[model samples]
Target: MNCYQKEDLIKMVEDAKQLTQKGKVADYIPALGEADPSTLAVAIYSGERECIYAGNIDEVFTLQSISKVLTLALALMDRGADYVFQRVGMEPTGDPFNSISKLESSVPSKPLNPMINAGALAVTDMLVGNTIEDKLERLLNFIRQLTGNDRITYNPVVAQSEFETADLNRSLCYFMRQHGIVESNVEQLINLYTKHCAIEMNCNDLAKLGFVIGNEGRDPNSDQNIIPLEIARIVKTFMVTCGMYNASGEFAIKVGIPAKSGVSGGILGSVPHGVGIGIYGPALDDKGNSIGGLRLLELIAKQSNLSIF
Candidate 1:
């Protein structure tokens, strides 16, 4: 249950950075396309005295799909498991995170899981708010509380960029609306979704948040409960199964821990009762995960035997 020394972490970060050159930065989102693919960073927090950091650990990036884990946790806290499960199923879709085909083909039209874009949208729609602004604020505040960082906020430019190029997401929302799955206003819900996805944080912030989850929803530093233990377990399970888009299985085999990745090249991982690891590598593999980030996790897992499996 020991954590890596700071020197070891720095060496691993340097090694992982080598893989960044082999991957491509996400270009689908115009804002994300501008990210420097060579930038690589990682932070590890043990929820105690040890905090290891390396590379551009202070570099901020949008949460992208990584925010789905937060929104899902908040939705569970707000609506409970039974009500939330009614909207999104527990199984993996096997399709890409943004694929619309599964929504069209699945019987009863429910999203296969909350980690996917459709399911995340459905979960976002379920957030209780009189307006989209209220919902976004509430979610942002929740993230701040979880990470103990009040300065965390969304990147407006990234939000606007995603909104402009979100025809596919818009189509998914409307289709769900037609099927009676999403009852909220499509535009407002989409805006909220984009806002959460654009929420920005550095690797250290991610480690702080993941540390809470690793400690079973309690802020180990303050010894306060941020989320109920049962709910935290549920969210972590989803991360282990569906967090890395279609590549979740491979990631599980390689890293053997619960993790969520964002297109902005962020990955949040919780090693149950152990450590919280956050990584940023703008370059992506075919499965849309941070290429160098995944390599880094695999290296840590192998060297440290960090995997729960």
Candidate 2:
């Protein structure tokens, strides 16, 4: 396969940004709800090169559900996959991310997988640091290492807004607590989990962050292991199987790349040995994926022949 020229890729992003005009901006988190639905941006990066950003490229957005990937990988590294799996399954649930039917079923299972809310809470509980502050600090440090952006930090407004509006997630925690899947104090665990979701980032930062997975857990730019290779594979598999909420299957059939999306309107896509893409379009489809972001990825993968399949 041939590499894409940076300028060509940039034009593609510019072309794709037009998709934003057709989407509706996110409006649930209150803070996120206010994002201009028409806002769109894209960032692409590889081990040694970076290319084009259109529209709000520098605008900071919360990681939202995308934080699940980072915390799950770190939890796996800290506590091993076996222990983590015991609290969260590795299957896709073709249901809304916040579905309670599976949780209420007879098997009384762990969350269907780590990309969902229940699974992410379980993984957050597994982080090995001493205190909430310690755990968050470790997570932040880990994120900065992966993205090569040491100044990154959590956004308090987003955290507070999520905390205030997360009754469904709160209910999920309480349910897990009842089921013995989440051993941490329900309130504390949810707090830590939401704050991590509030970790702020932009398109460029997310693309660079995704490189850790695209390059098999190594920070290609720094030549260091941000995530162990084995852990990276597991995380990537989760991205393929459960990343786009209930749309994972469709995305696999269509775009065919490992990816994760956040309700805050960001998608992090992995194109191994080529590029990691970050797309932002606040509007969401019924499944909660970035409407424009999804279109942009499909177009790029088709044009650049980046599909893993």
Winner by TM-score:
1
Give one digit per residue, the lDDT tens place, for model 1 in 1-309: 345377787888889889898899889999999999999898888876655788888899999999999999999999999999987899998899999998888898888999999999999998988999999999999999888889999999999999988999999999999998899988888889999999999999998899899889999777989989999999999999999999999889989999999999999999999888889999999889999999999988898899989
lDDT over C-alpha atoms for residue 215 of model 1: 88
- Of candidate 2, the 10-residue stretch with the lowest lDDT total is 1-10
Q: Once model 1 is optimally superposed onto the true structure by TM-score, how far is the C-alpha of residue 62 displaced, in angstroms? A: 0.5
Note the residue pairs that clash in candidate 1: none
lDDT of 2 by residue, 54-93 (tens): 6678988889999999999999989997898888898898
User: For model 1, what is the C-alpha lDDT against the true structure?
Assistant: 0.91
lDDT of each: 0.91, 0.84
